[model samples]
Target: MASDLSPASRRRMQLALLLTPVSLFFAVFFLGPLAIMIATSFLAPGLYGGVEWVFYPHNYGRILGFADPAFEDFDPVYISIFLRSLKIAAFTVIATLLVCYPAAFCIARLSERSKNFCLFLITLPFFASLIVRLFIWVLILRQTGIVNEMLLATGVIDRPLELIYTDGAIVLGMVYIFIPFMFMPVYASVEKLDWTLVRASLDLGAGPIRTFLRIILPLTSPGIAGGAIIVFIPALGNFVVPAVLGGAKVMMLGNLIEQQFLSARNWPFGSALAMMVMSVMLVMLFVYVIATGRRGADVTN
Candidate 1:
């Protein structure tokens, strides 16, 4: 093919050849696993807790409450768990955005050296294991932890607050872990912001709040949307945070899926639940892309 092509065409062929390995890698590692999971979802669970060769729609039915008559009453439990997961994920996204925006703005306004240093510091935690980071949180938020002792010393409370093993702790853990996702996109946008336009808005007698609302917010919306997507997707499917910090009292979709697979040995039901979570994430990603595309077009216009 290279021998038959012009120089430009040869170069293009070479580039395509180079990308083949990466494409094959993704197909094997990512697409292959997803395909297997989806296929397993459509099959029946065997007596020995594996998938049988038999095909059945029973798993989907179980998830949607079309299974047995007795299972009809349990539909509300699944719905409630899904709704609760959504609420927690939404709260995590909001909290991450709120905290990260100001930090990103400040970093974006800094000198290049300072910006890099700060970014390095913010990402330093990633060098450690995620489980270790979570354990650190447990040490901090536990009833007899340093945080409680510090509060007591400062006379902030008469008793140690129930800081750990609660929904509030789960939210706090999620926000802490996911803040970098929100920060990076917002920082990218803010770093590219035109301060001159802001000055011009001020010179044209627009108030600071109005300038921010009309100019800055609109221009930075794509970044916000990207961050929200990054934060919300993982939070919706989080298991470790809810299990460790929330004391297993608040069961998110991820935990339920784990239970189905591990404890109940119901692989088909777990696959169905996993597919449902994936479906929701795909829908969210689609909406986010459309919104960001429209915002980008508006900015250009």
Candidate 2:
């Protein structure tokens, strides 16, 4: 009976079968949750802790500064947290790039075996539990931690340095966790780089700095941008790193969202805060798409 059909019909049936599982998985896991969240974002918060079915745009108004006068007053802290999260995420990208870019070039120039070993070492941190790794940093940064103990023995100062629970500490933790994320992309770009162009630039009387800026930088920019996007997006919404390293003194957008949901019990407001994060991610994706499209067009020309 099946053999009676044309090849095109059979092919279409196969394609549909292949797509069915993926489509169902995405619809069930991704789209389902996203639809629920979007719906909840517009709904009012219940008196206790859950959501109310009624539409309430005030959830967003609370973030944008137009909350219902009777329920709650507007606060700028949400905006501040959003901005601070952006700043920290930007710093994390820069730091991760700085740490990975040079190392990528170094690895790219190494023997295949050595390069593989180094890559393995770079990824070895992932083998450990993230919480355990973060706790190691906490132990090293705390007042009675190793640094302080060593400094005290050397008599560097009477008091331990304030290292943990700061913005810098948060950035440091993010950089540590995101190094592998940034490195692999940059390494791929560097590994594929045309060294002959660099040599040609030098032979054409361009200085080292000029040759690098003109030849090497543009060629590897795609990887850098890729790494930056991956690093920045997750870093923006990272709560665990900040919670561990930043403490209560330093709160980011992720922490704010966590508090609204878990502590404050404002489900609508929490959903609103999550929507803000989703909005930022969408904007970043849009920018990346535009930049990628332009780069492709330039190459074609």
Candidate 3:
């Protein structure tokens, strides 16, 4: 005996019902996997190579504790690997920012049709397989590769420089792979910006440097944050670049965790290390949000 609802009300109900699928999808795909990973971190390693019900906090402790014959000391080797990963990630972020910022600015300034075309070009590499891209770098940066040959021909170097199988090569490979991530966010932000604000800054007696520092950079800060987080987090966890370009010599936390689980047969320990990385990423993302808020407020003010 209820009265029928209006069309708008029915539409609202339909939309609400539609959102249930999205919510369930997230729960199944994202939250469920994350829960499994956390549960695995607490479980003890099984004899046959799986999770055991024996819960031990020592797995986490052993990661931070000193390496000792008696299992009493912290492992410096793991600490060193973590530090090296941080260093490489930092370098990759810096290099990506330097290369992408100008390119993004240029793309942002282009006409809409041109902008889309340029973006497509940037994304073309993604269509190719990642392994293929890495292999291309191997060919380009090999000892007797085109780069070394060109340098030798130009007399820039007397001998072929060790371009491959080094930390530098790994960083270069990472930067190449990640540059698009850095570019896209910045370009989006830049494209949305009000050009009038920049003109106003210049109209006020602000020089180019002052305008950029005070106006443009602050307005585009969100993009920088997004791009940096995107680049840094993956670079921190990457195993492929170091393995292929670095010849397994420059081991990162990802490499160590991989070795622990696959080669060393220490699932519990690897899970602990992975949990630490995830925890650090969570903390960093929280801090980034706070910093973004402050910067946004400054820009609006």
* C-alpha lDDT values of all predictions: 0.86, 0.92, 0.85
Tens-digit per-residue lDDT, 206-251, candidate 1? 9999999998987687789888888899999899999889886789
Model 3 scores worst on lDDT over the 10 consecutive residues at 65-74
Give the per-residue lDDT digits (tens) of candidate 3, residues 239-279: 88988898857888888889988888878778888987887
Show where candidate 1 strays beyond 4 Å: 1-29, 52-55, 64-66, 70-74, 153-156, 299-301
Model 2 pairs in collision:
none
What's the CA error at residue 128 for candidate 2, in Å?
2.8
Error of 2 at 46 (Å): 1.7
Return the candidate ranking by lDDT, descending.
2, 1, 3
Best by TM-score: 2
Per-residue lDDT, model 2, residue 95, is 97
On a 0 to 100 scale, what is the lDDT of residue 254 in model 2? 91
Flag the better candidate by lDDT, 1 or 2: 2
Please rank every candidate by TM-score, starting with the best.
2, 1, 3
* Error of model 2, residue 200, in angstroms: 2.0
Runs off by more than 4 Å, candidate 3: 1-33, 46-52, 67-72, 153-156, 293-301
